[model samples]
Every structure is written in C-alpha cells, then in structure tokens.
Target: MDISFGETCGCKGYSVRSDILSEYGPSMANSCGGGNFVVFMTILEAFIRGRCDLSDPCNRVKPHSEPDYEYDFIVAGGGTAGAVVASRLSENPKWKVLLVEAGGDEPPAAAVPSMIASYWGDPAMDWNYRTEPESNACLGEPEQRCSWTRGKVLGGCSVTNGMMYMRGHKRDYDDWEKSGARGWAWKDVLPFFKVSEDNRQIGTLVSSEFHGSGGYLTTQQFPHQPAIAKDILNAAEEIGYGVTNDLNGDNFKGFTTAQTNNRNGSRMSTATAFLRPASGRSNLHVMLNSTATRVVIDPTTKVVFGLEFMYKGKKKVAKSSKEVILSAGALNSPQLLLLSGIGPKEDLTKLNIPVIHHLPGVGKNLHNHVASFVDFKLNKENATQSLNWATAMEYMLKRTGALSSTGLSQMTGVLNSKYAEPNGNHPDVQMFFSGYLAGCSRTGQLFEPLNTNNEDEKTTISIRPVYLHPKSRGYLTLASKDPTAPPLMYPNYLTEPEDIDVLVESIKMALKFGESKILSEKYGIEADKTPIPECASQGEWGTDAYWRCMVKVATGPENHQVGTCKMGSPQDSLAVVSNELRVFGIKGLRVIDASIMPIVPSGNTAAPTIMIAERGSAFIKNMWNWNKPPIVHDHFSSTDLKRNCGGVRTDTNDVKIDIQTQEREVVDWHKRHVHL
Candidate 1:
C-alpha cells in the first residue's frame, strides 16, 4: 500500500510512518473495534490536541475579571434573548452593560449537533425542571410528571435545542396583535427576524425577501444528511404534501429539510453569535456562574434599581443606572419577578413576602407546544451509526459526517389538522422525524431488544406529531421562598378534550407518511406493534380510543414554553408587560425573553425569542435616544407618549412618537439595511 506522508501528518511535530499508517488506516475504517482502531483513535486524539493548540483566544468570551459595581444596564440571565439584549445595548460606548448568567459557558460537547440528547438530564447543562403531576397527561412518566429540560448555560435553551430556525406562520404574530399586544403583527416583527439572521442560503435555497445576509447569527442547512432524510421528503410528497426548499418562506405549510442555527456544521448559539462578538467591547461585562435571586425594587416608587444575585457562594448586588432587563427565560423570569414581590398580592402575602406591586398575571397563562411520538419499524438495518470512529474521524478532519447533521431528525412537516381551517397557511400540526425510537428503560437501555439475525443493525424510527396550538393553559408559582428552589410548574398538558382531539388527528396525519408508497415500499416501514399496556383496554389496537389513550400516555412537551410573563395591553388584567416589554406597574424594568410572548407561536420559540430581544433593544434605544438621530417633525403629534413608550422619558430633545409611527420607521430603517 503506497501511503504517502508529507513533512507532517496534519498534527504538528508528529510524523507517521507510511507502513504504520497504511496498516491501521484501512483497518480503522473497516471496523469500529480492534487494536488498529484503538491505535488510530490515539493518533487522532494527538491531532485534536494539536488543533486545540492553534485555537485563538479571541474566539471565546472571557469572563470579566473585574466588574464595576454600577452599570447603565444590568441584564439578568445571559441566555438567548439576554445575550442579544446585552450585546445590542452595549453598542453605545457611553453605556456599560452587565450580563449575569447562572450557568457556565457551553461545554465542548454542545458544539456537536448529534450530541443534543446528551444535555437533557445533565445538571451542568440543563435546569432539569419537571412539571407537577397531571391526571390526563404524562401517565407513562414516573409519578405522572413530565420532564422539562431547560438550558442553564450562557446561551440558555439555544445551546441545548434542536437548532431548527423556524419563524412560524405570519398569522401567528398577527394573532398576537389582535389579542391586545399591539405593534407585534408579522410585518412589524419580520424585520427583526431578518436582521438577526445571516442566512448562508439566501438566493439559492431561501428567498431574499424573507432572509438576510451578513448578520450576527448564521443560518444554514447541515453540509451532510442521511439518505433516509431524502426518503422522508419523498414520502411527504407521496402523501400529497408540498416539499418546500424554504419552510420559512411563502409556503408555511409544507415539509422541508431543516435550516438550522449552524455555521460550518457546528451550533451557533446566541452566546457564540451575539455575545462573543461583543466581548471585545469595554462597555460589556459578562458574569458567569452567578444566579440572580431577586430584582430589588423600591417599594415607595415601585421602580427597579438593582438586582440581587449570588456569585461564588456570596450574595452580591449590581446596581442599574438606566434599566434592569429580565431575560431569564419563561420559567425563571417569572419566578424572579414573583420573588421580587411583583406578583399577585394574595400569593405574596401567603409567602410572607411584602408586595411591591400587586401584579395578578406574573406567572399565569403558561403553555407549550406538546407532541406525541409514534414508533415505526424498518425492514432494513441501520447502515450507519450516529457515533463511531469513522464518523468521528470524518467530522474531525473535514467537518462532514453524521455528526455534522442531525440525520432525519432535521426533516420537518407543517400541516393543518382536521380542526384547523382547510387549505389555510397556518398549520396546527408539525411533524418531526427521528432516526431512532427514543424509548429508554430505567436503566437507559432500549425498551425492546434489537434483532440480531441480520448482519446489519436493527432500526426503529419515531414520527413525532407536535400539536402547535394547545387551548389548555397552565401556571407556575414559587415552590418555596428559597431562590435555588425550582418553581411549581403545572403545564396541564391535554387537560382540555379539544387538545386531545387535535393530537389524535395529528397522529393519524403522521401515520399517512408511513403508509406512503415511497416510505412503505422502499424502506418497508411499518407501525411498531408494541402495545401500550395501559392503553390496550381502551379499544382495539389502532382505534381512536386506543390512540387517544396512547397519546395521553406518551405525552411529549416540547421545550418551546411561553406566556408566563405575557405581553399585553394594560387593560388586560393578565398583562405583565406592555408591547414595549416594560413591566406594567414598574419603571426601569423589562422582560425581553420568551416569557413575554402573549401566545406561543405556531412553531419553535427560539427564533421568535431572538426577534423579541431585537425589538426590545430597539425600544430601549428609541426611548433613551441612543442609536438613531432624533427626527423632529412639527406635523407629528404625540397622543400619549407615556402609554406609547412605556412612560420612559427621553433626552433633552423631548422627542415623542406614537408606537405605530416609531415601529414603522424602525422597520423601514431595517429594510433599507437588509439586502432585500
């Protein structure tokens, strides 16, 4: 074997003998387990070490060694939206921004797309929140409680999510506008979404009208995908569904390959995209491994002045001269608000905490996109393993392999169920395809044994039918007065009979793809016959009653939780924040994350949450008169500047503009900057 080795074998200061390389390389590629494979992996580790030696310090956000006691802005929670808000707010040299995150930075494993499952129950990465017991849902889970895994790292859930960049149907935001959250219509929020995205496939794969280029966050499809992904797309087409190139474009209801928040086959979390870019700014200071216990508000003025946090096991306070933004996400944001005495008076009194503001809707209206998984068995065996020496070598050398992509898990279908309007753009059901059945026993082994007769590996896939719009609402409250204690989360999944009906219809629709000629004939896909022991007595195997019983037993709550600190008009009693995201009865305080969502969007919440951060940052800048030059027009009349801009007073110019006029101007400004 004529194996050629140059001066070095990719690794610096390391030379490989042709004879040794020739012998081991071929053997490593042929089998996963062998002395040759072990030797090759040892050599690969040296190569990885050499590559790590060449890493640039500028790529990472170093923790601020010494943070000032006071800053112009104090952002609580350095998660998804919090990172964006801190970065955008620190753009001005005059303002100092402090970002406090409870968790540390994202680990090395988080960069790999296939390693997403590794973070679910990990205490270092996930908050590991579980919902309170529900009668109708989570029947199969231990104690009938569903596990809610939220990211605790700097990037928050973005660091631990599937990375699908879905903006949802335009009607989803329009519905928010109709329901008291004025100026949140699709047209108003679309510019922010475009500005935040730096899509790698603008003119080629996606429409220029819907995507932007040269932005902070990079959005692109993974370089490689499994062969089954194409089959899934074909199956969707065979089942009378449109296969689209861009799911976020004109046709919202369709099946498409995933466009994710990735750059060069790695995850581009908000911390990586937004915060790291702003790390060089002297005005921005990031404090990691710190938990914000409470927002200190003046009882007399009902104004937030500073935040109380614990760092290095000692309580500390960071004063905010301008504003304090709560971007701690849905669960923690409201929990922090209640701890600061900004919730219902009755609840605060019961906890013996003095109420600074009697806000009745601090932790109300909690809900999420719930799903149910249906297992399918393939006649063939798994040709490739997700994690193996070959895949590891390919990814390490060329950044292309199974590790580069999420396989068929990235293929998604958006369709309306029988309950939704026929032939409408809005979709009620979103289908997720997985390459493996996610069922695991208490010992973390597969529930069913693999068929060992074939030479290849046995394969079992899952089709998840996500009910996008659930009518049932839930709430969250303080489990205890202790800041470290987890909140009592009552997701109340499938409490309403209508919610179960939607899931049933969605499940049937997903089963159609398995029955399609392309999937059934080519892949020999069949529904898994494993009986749900609790659901068998409901009806015959495939009946609606049996499926309904199975749906409740196999309830899957997606991580897209929202509406706890809902944004709404002040007239609405449940309104925690105004459209500008300012807390109702408080001054110099805002919530810029997913918690402020009035209603959950039709799809994933990550993209929408980033858009909210962009819009909220603009509101702060506009009110403080920082970024754009004030345009004074005598013809323009301000109806009520207080209500329009959340009662925030501007500079000496005293420039006052209505919410609609300001939003239009901001959108136009962003439009001019964008390529399209």
Candidate 2:
C-alpha cells in the first residue's frame, strides 16, 4: 500500500509519485481505480537499478591470477585506515609491505572535482552493501534495505564519503579514556592527525592555526560552498550557536565551512596520497581483487603465521614474516577474525569454527554517526549551471563566466552543535551540509551529474548527529563457519533512549536553521514542513520527542563501523586488544582499522581512522611503546580562532533558538548573490 524509495530493494528516485504501487508487485492487488496488472516488473526494475548502487557481484567478474607473496607485513582493506598504516609501516625500506584491496585504484571520475558526485554507490568503487531491514529512513526506496555505500577501491570509504573533516571534541577522547580505553586521549592522538595531513590555510573565514602542513592527505576549504554557508552561519548566530572560525578548534562550538580531503577541486582519497606515491616501489606489492579469508594460525601456539586469501580463484598464502595486521574495516575486519576463530565462543561454535580465542568483544561496541534530514521545497527560478566543472569549463574554454567557480562542489559543512549535556564544554551534535540534492537514485547509483533543475536548488539539509557518548552497543558475528560467508551484525540503534533524544534535537536544529532568513533567500529554500510522525507520537514531543522519532527513522549505522575489536586496558572484559591494538591471545596480529575504535568519534571517520593507523604505526614500531608529542597540527584545537570578523557561534539549542527566532524576523539578509 505504501511505496517507499531510496533504500535497497526499493524504487529509489528524486521524484515522488503518489500512486505507484497499484502498477507493480505480488499477488496482484488492484488498489488503483481499476484492473490488476501482475507484471513481472519489480524484479526486472530492481535488477537493472540495483547494480548502479553497488559492485557487480564478485562471482560475476573474471578472477585475477594468483599473487606472489612477499612482505614483512601485509595489510588487508586498502581504505583510509589501511592506506595510512601501510604507508607509515613501509616507511622503512628494509621492510617489505603488501597492501591488498578487493578493488584496485580509482577511475578518472574519482579524480574530477565535480565528479565527486560520481563516487556514490558506484559499482566499481563502492561496496554497495545493504544492511538488514531497518525500521527507519530510506523513505520511498526499494526493498526497504538501508543502503550502506562503503568503498571497495583503495582509500576505502574516504574515496566515496562526503569529504567533511572533523575530529570530534577533545572531551570525546577523555570519555573513551574514562571508559577504560587509556592513552587515546586527544592530546596523545592529535599528532597522528597532523602526521597524516597536508593542511591548507586557504580560507579567510576559518583560521589556519591547527592545520598541518605538507602532510599526505590534502585539506582545504570547499571548492564551491553552496551559498548556504554564510547564511546558515548568520542564522545560527542569530539563533545563538557559539560561532567559531573552526569546528576542529578547542571550543568545538561554532559553524564554518567544512574542512575537506580535497585537492584542486577533487577528493584526495588515501590511495591518492599514500599508496599511489609508492605504486612503483618494487618492494610494495599491491594486490587487487583479492579477498582475504582468514589469518593462517599455528595450531600448537596461538600465533598468526600468515594470511589465507583468494585472489581470482586459487587460494594463496601470503606469509607474514613479521606481522599480519587486519585493516579490513569495521565490518570485514572482525568478519575475517571471526572466520579465523578469534571471537565469542558461542558464535564460533555455532558456525563450527575452531575456537582460537574466546574474546567476547571481537565484534561488539559498534557506534556510528547516524542522522536525520529535513527536505524543504522552495519556489523555482530558471536553472543555471551549478558551481562545478560545468561552470569551471566556462573559464577553461572562454577564460570567463562561472568557470572560475570554487568547484564549490559543497556537499558538506562543519558545525559544532551542542546538546543539553551537563558538561559545560561538551556539545551533542555535529552538522554536515552536503551541497547537492537527492541524486537520481537513493539506491544510490554512481552519481550522474545533477539535473540542472527547473530552478537553482539548495533543496535540503541533512541534519546529522551521532550520540556523542553512546551507551547503545552493536556487534558483528559469524553468519556461518564458511570463510566466504559474511558476518551478521546487529547495530541495535535507538534501542537506547539517549540516542533517540540526540537525533530529534538535531532535526529541530536543522529545521530552525532552514527557517533562518539568511538561508531561505540564499538558496531560495522553503520549508516542506513534513511533520515527523514519531517525533509527535512520543507524547513528550518537545526536543526530546522529536529526536526519538528521528532516531527511530534514521538510526542505522553510517558504515564508519568500529569498536568490534575494541581496544582498551587488558583488564577490560570486552577488550579484544590492548591499547597498542595487538589482538589478545595472538602474536603478530594487530587490528589497524576502524574495527579497533573503542568508540566512534564525532564526525567523518576517515580522518580519525587514518589517524589511528598513523598512531598505531608508531606504537607498533615501538612494539606498543609509542612516545611522541601531542599530535598538534599547525592548527590548535584550543587556540582561539575568532570568527572571520563576520561570524558568530550558533551552538547550543537555547542560543540557537534566540538567534534562529531573530533570523526568522529578518529574512532577506544577504542583498545580492556573491559568488567567490
């Protein structure tokens, strides 16, 4: 009776057609004004469209030849975390390292500035993973499966993720320390971020204080920031957000242009930064299309000797003369470990797997940056090319026009949102403002260029916020003993009352932000006023009720999956590894991936994930004795960055309400369109 779009197995599209179901599907029901049409159409449509969101099934592709084994350490999953780990560890030429990825490098589209849009659910670049049915968000999508778009190629999710770079508030790390995860404090881990960054102090808006210099990963101001940034900031200031120049700064209370991992208008994935630099190295063996099955362990001693992988068809063994690190990401890293029998005893036994270790936390403590969004429809005007290559081409060819555009390929923002936390310094939400709209499909096909609409659009703002400190925990367990079988994960979201509260507040903030007079005129947006059903039903429908509803709807994982193999002090029960990231009960086995996150950080996981590898490499090099200065970038988190002379801090809900209400009173704040 209800036609949903954008989730897996669902009919996903930008347009909403009211009467769609009567035209399709099982048992032939004719709710439409007349006759039944039992067309075998759903399957065909799904088959055709679904392929756009994910990779072609691995079995369908031709297999590559067997790989030659040569490495002191072989890192699996060449994503954000993997690339950093491999790059750092291999810094020693005396050591040989091999980085194996299921997908190879990226395509030209991945390198294009505006074409960052093409990275979504791209079959070649995306893992196109679907989560088990969620009770929430993928409205109007096919199949109701929550679409999980992870990267398959090198640079992992960073290659495909929205390029927002926010290291969460320092309080976040302190909490992790309080929860038994020691030595992961902000002061200690910041160096890793600095080591991995090539910070650019380009923007006059945010200060260049803490930004790193000449590091591998490129950091910059958005190329083309949808005119929304200033208006949103102004409105947020009116509403009382503690506007700051940088969200990554110490106060963590402000709104500003999002920091990104882009260079010259294109995304700078880790592969582009680290692995690509050493692609020609003879000692660096990079394997593509290879699926690692499990760690080859010694039967007599619980030592991981090598890795068993399937490249093409033949099973191959890549001996780890030194160590076998699992960088297979939050999802697959634990999956690989479980298949190798290093997990919860019950799970391994059920799958008929050998029990190498009885670590209960092998796949527990999952956290994600879950979100909810507001869709506002605005009055339309004649459409013009957006600020990307289409406009950039104008400059390239004619040496004029919108071609000089900043590639303002903005799909992101950086805001330090605050909650009603008792702690004075800590805030609850972090907002990311993506530049584009609902792309052609929510099944998330590789992004085709946006349709130059009937009007210039700033259509919607996705109000994303994670539980700053979540008590709700999730896990990844073995589906079967078979190495090929993927693990089963349950991210028991919104199962907690706190997480529910956080999202509802996030949506309200977004709603208020959109209502700001400055935002409305800039992008020409009008509020859709689509009431959230759950927000109202909780009977406690203030900020708390609204958040609960948002959680119920959008409470799925962001696929920045981690904490499965949680790192903590040895005495911690759920800990599968020490603070050093070495797996318990096993030698030469360390998890240098998102799977080792004791808790998920506040914003985009790529930056922190890479930092983990950077820090982990140091620790591993010292055999867990890494002693270095706080990872301070040229930029300082605590170093005050006054707004760019024209900014305010619109952080807390109370402050935001006051400012938002004022902005509501003054709608047309920006008099003219200023394209910088």
Candidate 3:
C-alpha cells in the first residue's frame, strides 16, 4: 500500500522518496541544475543574480545529509500562504502532509524584537528585488531598489512581512462576487477568516464571532503604538476619517489603532502557529530542501495524475489517488502548471515545451498591490532607536516591550476621499504606516557584509499609500524550459490611465491625514512636500506637469502578485481556474494559493490567505472523505464556503453560471467520525 507524507522536518525544503532510496543515488546533491537563488551571498552578486534581475536567484544549497522520505501533500514554498494550508490540512491524523521551503530555517539576525528597525540592512532573512527601472516614485534617493523581503523559513513571509492585520471593507468581498468569485462574498467568507484566527487581545465568543477560539494563530493589536503610530491615525482622523480601534468591524474606511499577528511580542507567523504544532503528528510529514520540478499528467487526456520532484540528488514521483492541490504560490504555481502543459499554447510552443492542454489563462491577468513612499521627519528623539543594544537584550530575554513590535505602527486607514463623498460603498484608497522612513532606493542584498560603524544612520518613519484595485494587470512566463529558472514576472503596473486616476486620489488622501493636530504633537510628523511635485523630473516638482509626471513615475509595485492563474468564467480569455479553483479543462487538479485570487483583497494577503486555506482544507476533506474516513480531528462546520461553492450554480436563461448544486455527501461519514 502507498501513502504520502507532508514536508520533512527542518528547512531543507521539499524532496521526493523512493522505496529504493538505499539502493540508488548519492547522499547530499545539488540537482537545482546550474542556476538557482542562494540563501547567502555578496550583495552585488545577489542583486545581479536575483529573480527580478534575471528571473532566477542562481544558487543551490549543498545538503549535509542524504535524501529523505515523501509525504501525502508536498506544499511548495513555506511562506505566509503555505504555512496556513499545511497546518489546517495536517489536523487530520489519518493523512500525512509535507511542506518544502527553499530557504534554510536559521532565524535572521534582525528577526529579534529588539532589532526590528535593522531588518532592511540585514540580509539573513530578506529577498531583496529591485525593478529593472522605474519612471515616477522615490525621490532624492541614490537608486530605486524596491525591497521584496519575505521570510524563507517555515513562517515564510509572515516572519518578514509588516505584522499589521487590516480586515478589508465589506465591499471588497462584494466586489469579488461581482467579479466572478460568486459564492465568496463577504458574509460567506468572514466565518472562515474568524475561524482560522485566534486573537490574543480579544475575548473568544466576542472575538470568535469573527475569530477562532482554540485556533493556533494569534493576533494582538500593537503592544505600544509608539509616538509615530499614534500620530498617523490622529492625523488621518483630522482629515475626516472616523477614528476607531478596530478596522475589522463593520466600517473599515477610517483611521484606527493598528492590529497585528504578534503574541506576547514575538512574530506569530502561520508556521509558528499552525505548522510547527503538528510537526510531530505521525500522519503528517514535512520535507525541507526539496523542489517540486513538475506535475505528472496523463498525456493522453491531459488529466493530472501525480508530481515529479528532486530529493537529495535523485528524481522521484508521487501519484495522487484522489486530488493534487497546488499551493506553490502565484509565480511558481502557474509556472508548474504551464511547465506540465497546462498554460497558453502559444507561450508553451515558444519555449518548445509540448502543449498537453491549451490552457489559455495559465499565466495571464496578473494583479498586485501598488505603493509609494511618503516621508516627514521633525526630529530624532521620537524616532525608533537607531542602534539600541540595551533594549534588544530586554526583548530577547522576556519577550516584552518595543523590540517585539512589528515595524508598522498601524495600518493607515482605508479612505474613499479626504472628505466623505456621499457616493460609493468602497473606499477609493488605502495607506500602510511605517516607523522607518525608507526612501525609494532599491534594497541591496541582505547578504552584504555591513561595515560595523555605519549602523546609526538608518532613517525613521515611512508612510506608504498603496493604490488598491488598480485596473492594470501583469503576467508570468517561463524564461526557459528548466524548472530551476524562476518564472519571468511583469506586474504591468500603472499601464492604464484609469489605474493612474485612482492612485492620484490616494496620494491626496494620505496628505490630509498627515495634517491632523493630535498626530503632529506625538510623532513629530510633517508632510515634507506640501503639494506633491507634479513632474516626473526635478524640473516639474511644483508644477501640475510634475504631479502628472510624478504620478506616472512615483510608484513602488506591491509584491503581492496574484491573479496569474485567475479564477473566473471559462469564457473569459484571462480566466485560468473556475471559481472552484480547478484548472480550466483539467480533471482532479486544483490551484489554491495566491494564484487563484480572482481579485486582490483590501489590505494584506496574509489574513485572507489563511482564510483560503481553511476553506480549501474543507474542500479537500469533503472530496477525500467520500470513500475513506478520517479517524481523528473532528471538523465542526457542516457547510463550508468552498464545499458550498463547489456545488450549486445560479443560472440565467440567456447565460449559464458555473455553480455546482449537488448535495454534500458526507452525512453517514460525518456521523462515523465526529459521532454526530
């Protein structure tokens, strides 16, 4: 009999297993095949060799041991999204789960609560990516190197991301249903969001009404807002935002206290909360240092059958008896699909890769959060300590105080305009507040050797206003046939005029908040540029032409890339998966991670990503339990949105919708397992 495990222990990433592992293959191999990203290297080399620079990080880890075993589900990429998916799925004792992370698990030096301000310069935990070039944003900065930092360990991006948790406005979900992710409306998905989280600050039922009680994930509003955090919200309120403590409640369009995924001052990454707890479960398996190279499909019908990956130094395959879920993330998921012959025929043909199925929507319709840096500094006393060694000691030992703070003071409010327009339900703009005044210079390699004397010069406080829901779209494509090559990605940011119009309004909204009276006295905040320079060039700064030119050039693209494998109507050219998240025209295969987002959510993707995992876990459980039953870990919900979406479609006479209305077939089995 055959069974699969999840990821192996440690941060070695994912690898395959053979019944004959002892019979063949060497111990510790570098099958990354020439080019790949390295965990640590020189700053310049890292930049020159990174994915954004050339679509491949070009380095591989040389293992110290032999290849290990396989798991039931080998989740590729153990970052923010991967952690929640692996954790929820592993709850069942009858099945094994595996999570493969590309980066090694050693904690980054700046990951400590005390050194939060130094993360940008710390290479141990960051994946810095600079654009080829930009037209408008960061000013007076040496070079534009936008930093794309994400934790490479089990917690993934959660460990590295700003810990602010902002629940989007209700209209955000309303928009999804309108866009084609029909059953996933706000009210429908809210429970999953609440169910997946366990807030450290709120009461269970009171919070559990929208939060989980016994759930592993924990969230706490910032321990101390710091002068900078408090003033930003105060300033926002002065500009007309209704100040409130909770943004997760009814109306999200206002200034509010910051909420975060920190428990007792330590980062509450999904891995720390979800994956780590179940690591010892015999039914769950985790593999580190393994890379899933391709999906094995039935060449005759184009039906997906299993997957192919490298373990240690040898190749191995794992067949899926029921379903194979892809949670490898946006770039990699679509790349894997296209590599296995599931993307556009033309694109596939160009790389000389065979077309197993003409999946036209495979790597198209990309979406990303776009942002810009705005700075105002009055003094240094209120700023976060530049290099405070004493404070660091206190935080590490007791897990108390400022060191534990996630760099963000709060999620700047969601705004429709500076003044309330009696117009739409959705807010037109949103802003993220930072304690560090990061200029637009692209972040250099985290692996760069830092001169010990230069530690005190880091700046203080940055307020970035992200242009939410721009009409612009991007794409992901393979640079080569090699699986080791990172997918070529283009966010195609601000390509459309309509996208630019929305962003223009967003910048003005941020300025209004900066003018608040309460915030100025506390944080020493100031709006350096009274009127945003109109020109893209220095000559146009005070002119309307400069504003227009700056609008075009002044944006830092959101690293939250999604919609590459967009989920929507099959008739649409850009729709890769249906609302059920199944690959278009494929059988027994699905793409769950960030790749299937029909539209990006209101704020950060981490919270919403966890909710998606909760829903997907139910979908898989429902599908798998049709035959075999889980003997442990009782799931309480009778009706899950994912399972509900999978069934029942609404139809109009002139047109057809893809809703599946079949009855949930888990009655008798439910009784057997939970004794209901």
CA lDDT scores, all candidates in order: 0.76, 0.59, 0.56
Highest-scoring model, lDDT? 1
What local lDDT does model 2 show for residue 273?
70
lDDT of 3 by residue, 41-134 (tens): 1221222111110110111112223223444565666667776666666766666665665554423222333333333423444445333233
lDDT per residue (tens digit) for residues 402-440 in model 2: 221223234333343454556656666666554443112
Best by TM-score: 1
- The TM-score obtained by model 1 is 0.85
Error of 1 at 462 (Å): 1.0
lDDT of 1 at 359: 95
Show where candidate 2 strays beyond 4 Å.
Answer: 1-66, 134-145, 202-209, 380-389, 392-419, 437-462, 465-467, 520-524, 531-550, 554-556, 624-676
- Per-prediction TM-score to the true structure, in the order listed: 0.85, 0.75, 0.75
Model 3 steric clash total = 57
lDDT of 1 at 491: 88
Better of 1 and 2 by TM-score: 1
